[model samples]
Target chain A: MTSNDKIIEIEVLRYRPEQDEKPFLQSFKVPFTDDQSVLQGVQYIKDYLDGSLSFRWSCRMAICGSCGMMINGVPKLSCKTFLREYYPGKITLEALKHFPIEKDLIIDLSDFINKLESIKPYIIPAAPRTLEQGEYLQTPRQLDRIAQFSSCINCMLCYAACPQYGLKPDYLGPAAITLLHRYNEDNRDAAKAERMQLLNAHEGVWGCTLVGYCSDVCPKDVDPAAAINRNKLNSTMDYFLRFVAPRGGN
Target chain B: MSKRSNEPIVWSLFGAGGVVVAHTMPVLIFVTGIAVPLGLVSADVLAYERLAGLADGWFGKLFLLVIISLPLWQSAHRIFLSLHDFGITGGETFFRVVFYGAALWGTLLPLFLLVGM
Candidate 1:
């Protein structure tokens, strides 16, 4: 174990909306402990060394889902990634990929939220259930089918890895679509037909070029790429079988 | 151009074809082709006895034909997609050509083998 007195070489992406026209990288050396996270290292610079540097974070423990950034060219939550991983080496920190820089590490995630809204992101039953019957029943196997898809904390790491979303802004990126699937698979939810109508659009599942990076970068192993791909298969089958079975979208 | 990932259609076809080629063609040579009949003796019996038994009869021929043809079509389809991802845009006609070619020969092989003189 090395002392915390050592300075770690950090090259961070810097952008000033009020000053600079575009984003660029700036290097700084900050002394940090092995126990400290990259977020702590950034805080050290912001608090003592350079107040001009800006990034977003809260909870400092990785739960807030607010501190995702491109660390060493990979999108990760700064609060979770250990500084010891890059000890004695130069690391380049940048804003999350695929979104325009709002300032330093901040990105315009408004578009992402809008896509989230597009899916309705809630349960809508085909018919209202009576109070006597209680909630819809689902088996463990059914839950397993979509439970792994539900662990996403919306860190947007998957979006940063998806080249398809970067190339096409209109494409509904991984995180939001994964949320859509969360509700779509719920047995208590009867809106598969309605949801499928929205999800089958161009900006929906079809927009995915299947770059597969979304699954790779996902911290929760939600496999949004697989979700979208499987949904595509389902939607296509449902559409083709529509004539044979008039109510087949679900 | 954007890179496509391990979509099942592309990968499964490619993989199954590679496996079949590695496992099947060599057996055909020692057991039935110019090697076995001419006593070239350049093959393994235990390595292929079970598989050879299956391929000896009509049912086996049918199974082999189905497996081999499907993988070829799949490989062709995957290769086309791989080409598209690499930004080699020769147009959709290339796909149509493969489709029609697959349609033409994909069925013809079974028809030829099953109903041959």
Candidate 2:
């Protein structure tokens, strides 16, 4: 360690099912540089301080979305957050909120995964097109409609930020519904009517209270709140139009 | 498929009332509450006979009814949802009846008064 390297205290919330009855904060003082990220600091802890510490991370960059945690009570990608910002103050690292922690700083994502699968994330083609018929064509404007909603990395930060999901676990949370909207908005998709049924339910878009923190905490600026609200309009129209039109204006 | 929520009916009202409130409430408050009381404009601008004449017209009655009634619906919808946020999960039907019933009452009472006038 160089003389210029500053020491920062990182308190990680630890839970081992066989060993500990409950999760507890374990502090470690680590030497770090201004250039290093919070993820690197935790890496240093694992390398030298405690090998028993567990967390999930694939890419040191933010693209992988695996290193999300509660840093000072805010959901953030630890890889993108610099240690220099919290240099003088102690940093608390905990598993993402509104999820069951699997181990230290690692959350069980089964529920989120199940919700993801239920949304039918892939496009169900408007019509069957054979290889001889050629690929589906979309205009720039058509792609733009669904592009923003497609940026979600499945980091679950928005899920951590959502109070509604925290209250009602079954409420098809932010990222999943946002992805559902993404597919629905795509011009080549034919299953809008099929998908709209999920959104029409009380557990669907109606579950969102427009807390909007989901948009605020998003690393990619996905704006899940806007997607959900837009679908609310669609859902509302569907509710009334179903009585008049045969397909409910789908 | 899960049963659909009846929220869209009230949510449409909430959305409409939100627009009306956003567009008109500030102007209404400024004109009636602030400017008229402060005499920034002439007091006769809101004289009772003149106001009564405005209410007597069909268009004016419709306008008054919309301004008064829609906001009550908006507030009722908001308060109803806020009950969930505040963690009061029981007696959903009771709360819905009380809140929406009050907004309905607000709507009809104005219609009757404006027509009776």
Candidate 3:
């Protein structure tokens, strides 16, 4: 073997409902180079070792937002996490926290998906214009309001990082709420009133304790905590101002 | 289907209290606790008669009420949420009643004291 070949133990949490009743750890000795990522290590195991192993990944690049897993109990994208960092030692890979394990490394994202869909993630324009009316122009300042929030890639790493979401699954989570703020801040969007209705609930931004772990774990630097807090301020204003002008003022 | 939460009422108090405490509490602390005792400023600044005179005005009474009461609300809200964060959920209503109810009492008592002055 060449000196460049570095062998490391990769322990993956395996769960197959058909054969195994419970999830258990399975370790593989993976030989990798310094440039190989943790995802590549798992790919090596699948290609050369156990083909039955299951996981989800696409666009080996970090932008796909897939391949998020719990590495040493921290949420990270396997594509971005290098196995060389954990070389000469064993690394454990498990399904992302706060999510149900569908298979080995594949997690059930349906709950997060449902919550994302509930937030009306698409833009609802304040005033509709036909194609003949040309594009809606916006100043840089207008873009700046929502720009930071618009970077969320829906990786759900923030969800795994959020203790509030783990405790209260019904809570409208970080990414979805950040996306809501994105649309609300868009100058072309006029659905702030409708969006405010969703945000004015107990399960909305109020549910967030501002642990800020979500922001810390976000790969895209999307500060969902800030988005939620800002909306908290908005919801507070709406709550009190409802007494003054009950209807469309929001 | 959107549901409205009454958390805004308490949250507003918390926000206002946060602002009041952050902005003015340090100055109050330095002026009353440190400067007054150290004689860094004039003793007449907090003399009994001078304080009484300030309290006699409606605006001064209002200011005192806001300064004293809002911080209480803020602390109560923070404590209440912190309890929830710590996985203590059985006494939710009880804690709310005790914490916020105490703040309410604190607020009322100060108003009564300030107005009587």
Candidate 4:
């Protein structure tokens, strides 16, 4: 909006399924201030330069977890990434890597959604109780166990950064497993045995060779890599214990 | 989707091996290769007669077995997974057999060598 504002080039990867056989890079130059984010730059292109540009973003403050994309080959939330950091150099924007692009900047997240559902991301009560039985109280120490993992907003950035998930799509990738562990760590939850069966599989935590990039790309500081590795110890114990006591577990 | 895998059996071995390699191998290397040669430890501490005597003992044989065998499993698992990371998808069963078979051989060879002494 200022006369002294500088113009920057944003090279966006475009793919219209009905129009193009493959994705291609298209550039747009837009004037912007130093404080503006990459999301604003894309919005400018949509509002002023081209109306057909497609992307998903709901919360501009980074909490809604919808505006994630590949910014210069790294997974990042557009709303949290500043364009001024790359002012002189042009920036490349692509859909999250390792996922099929549905449109220009949107990716097909149906696989991620399905995995999220399979984890049963809810507290299965250790014992059923009526409303009059009162609230399930947890000490701060008990809360600390799963609090860090609960920060995941389902952004799927970890999946984009994971080499295992890229190689094996059925590997039950990071965010879902982190969420799964969050519920399993709850004191009131008795579903650890049931969830352990899913985690004990070949494609579960073992699929992760501990490449550890999932934790690096997490904007929310949710260390899915730690969650997966911790569960590996539990899974290992379960694997041996099953031979001795087939019907016994937490 | 919830079918169990035999990976835990191997992974536990790999994990234990990794711990031994990480925690003990350096100390072992330094003590034998540098400490004795540099006289930080007396040359007589690792004398050939003493080392042979160690190899002849049951406990020392167990220690040598653990030190030699576990690291083999660790290195093999690492290599097996590294190959997969490099996008080598074909002949997976063949690769597993060869790599793990080599590790098993390494383990057994040490056990026999130490016990036979």
Candidate 5:
């Protein structure tokens, strides 16, 4: 409302399944200050401009991994991206790529969720340790091995950035594979053989052509590309070792 | 149990070829294209008789074979995968045959030529 406050145009891709034949861009001019984020801008539109505008957001600080959208065609957390950066120009917002849009700026994450579940994200402990044995202890070195991959916040930015996943929807994409690697690297976990089955398949690590955009767009610095590449080596060894070793060297 | 991919067999070749290309290709290019052509290194270093002699030896034949063949495999794998990226998803088996078959021929032709030499 201040005299110096600037008004910026936000073109949002809107889809109302009941009414619209297809998604369309609807623009809104909003007044914003330098410190306000894209999320805040969208919120302002929802609160004042249009009540029915829909989007998912929480934490407003990029931790929840929601609020992901294509801002100028790049997958980004709207909460972390400040409006000031895209000031003086129009910003086009759309749902994340390679996902089915549920509504305006909201994507159906069931595919990603199913992929996450299929990876067996939790460690299947080597042996059932009794409470008397206490917590599963890990050395710093052991933790270090899986720590980077463990930082993934389940943000689908990597999936949006992955061309392979975009091309082949069944490709087991970045975040899920990275999470699978995290559990495989855990010293206390002995279910690598079980998990490696998923990775050994064509839909697994073999699907990745190492485009590496997944690592580049990762908000948490979880290099899913590196994780996938490392697993490729592991999978290759497993593939050949099966013929020589009784247990396939799992 | 998920069906395992045979990509590992081809990927192993690709990985090995990539390593060989990364480590030696630059040196090979510089030696032949730059150093010898520019006369920075002696032309005699790559003289025809000496070159043939090197190719005739077991170690040199192995080196030459690796230098020539591995890169073909590497390029074949990369081109094959790139076809997927280019949105050519159909006839994967045909494309695989075309790309990897050429690499196979490249490997065999050199082996036969080197042994005859």
Candidate 6:
């Protein structure tokens, strides 16, 4: 019950871009306290043992959405994984999966960023209006419909848990689809047709095999699976009703 | 996710066929059911008897084998997938060992039992 009992072995996956063709594991013995987080341990390692260690981190808390990595083969935020929870043990740390690794825990999020940009992330009104039209009003139920998905911080942990994304990087991924769901269900927004174009494409919604891991691994409870699946339903209706509905519906 | 999502009409057909085999095969196996949807869904999806039929001269037995194995494969894959999503995994190596072994039995068990040698 004191300051003396502090010893934990940590394994870190390493890659030196110039020297190594691929990545490998490196181990360190860190002195950890009961309250220490995995990110704290990583900080200790980088600060003391090796400045060469690479990983992404911004908010020491889970909010910045930047610090997602794999701990023991499952995607997690280093800021959140407590050392006490995994006590008297060896911890394995690796880069988030399903993304191209730039070095260590850092991955090229260009794919995910591009996906977000393509979905018309903002609201498109049903014909832009002036103050004379008044602000489009919405009921409580309408706000609740798209509210859950809007909590996404874009951490990309869902992509890390998803094997389909790893197997096919072209897949639109969970976060972007969740964003699309946000706008799709927003009563004030009228851009379903624009979002539908991206959702209905070959590399879009169809790529999901419904493995359902994305939702399971999601920290925000955004339920990207439900959003993506619902979008598919939306697209299917749009496809079949193309003749009957307004041609420029979006 | 969407109700309007593209339902793979072909897979749905396979699923229906497998469900039929799943229900009927147990009755056929014992040849005494009053009438129902009875056999094991997992066994039918695997199509283990398909291999048995390839080995045996009996056409009826062969047909049953093919029909039953489909349900077995479909069910097992779905089961493992559910396990994975639940995060109840023993890790990747553990999953590979368990699933690959199950797949082997999925293909070979019926043939070994039905065709002899």
DockQ, ranked from best to worst: 4, 5, 2, 3, 1, 6
Pairs clashing within candidate 4: none
Clash pairs, model 5 backbone: none
Best by lDDT: 5
Off by over 4 Å in 2: none
**What local distance difference test score does each model get?**
0.75, 0.93, 0.90, 0.92, 0.94, 0.76
Question: Which candidate gets the maximum TM-score versus the true structure?
Answer: 5
Q: Measured with DockQ on alpha carbons, how good is candidate 6?
A: 0.05
Indicate the worst ten consecutive residues by lDDT in candidate 1 chain B.
Answer: B1-10
Task: List DockQ, one per candidate, in order.
Answer: 0.11, 0.70, 0.68, 0.82, 0.77, 0.05
List model 5 lDDT by residue over A188-239, tens digit each.
Answer: 9989999999999999999999889999888878899999999999999999
Q: Compared with the true structure, what per-residue lDDT tens digits does model 1 show for residues A1-250?
A: 2463778898989999999987888888888776889999898889877899988898887667789999999988999898889987888899999898898998988988887887778778878789997987789998997788878788888889877676668777788888888888888787777767656666677666567888987766679988887777766666566668879634
CAPRI verdict (incorrect, acceptable, medium, high) for model 2:
medium
Any residue pairs clashing in model 3, and if so which?
A: A126-A190
Candidate 5, residue B82: how far the Cα is off, in Å = 0.8
After TM-score superposition, the amount by which residue A55's alpha carbon in candidate 4 deviates from its true location, in angstroms, is 0.5
Q: How many backbone overlaps does candidate 6 show?
A: 27
Q: How do all models score by TM-score? A: 0.76, 0.97, 0.91, 0.96, 0.98, 0.69
Candidate 1 vs candidate 6: the TM-score winner is 1
Cα miss at A16, model 2 (Å)?
0.6
Give the C-alpha miss distance for residue B38 in model 3, angstroms. 7.2
Candidates by lDDT, descending order: 5, 2, 4, 3, 6, 1
- Over A43-142, each residue of candidate 2 has an lDDT whose tens digit, in order, gives 9999999999999999888888999999999999999999999979999999999999899899999999998998899989967999999999999999
Residue range with the least summed lDDT across 10 consecutive positions in model 6 chain A: A241-250
Q: How many backbone clashes does candidate 1 have?
A: 0
List residue ranges in candidate 6 displaced over 4 A: A129-136, A246-250, B1-117
User: Can you write out model 6's per-residue Cα lDDT over A1-250, one digit (the tens) per residue?
Assistant: 2578587888999987889899999999888888899999999999989999988898887888888999989898899888777768799999888788898778989989988998878889888878998888899999999999998989999999887777667778888989988998999898887677777765677667677888987777779999887776666666667757677334
State the TM-score for model 3.
0.91
The most accurate candidate by DockQ is 4
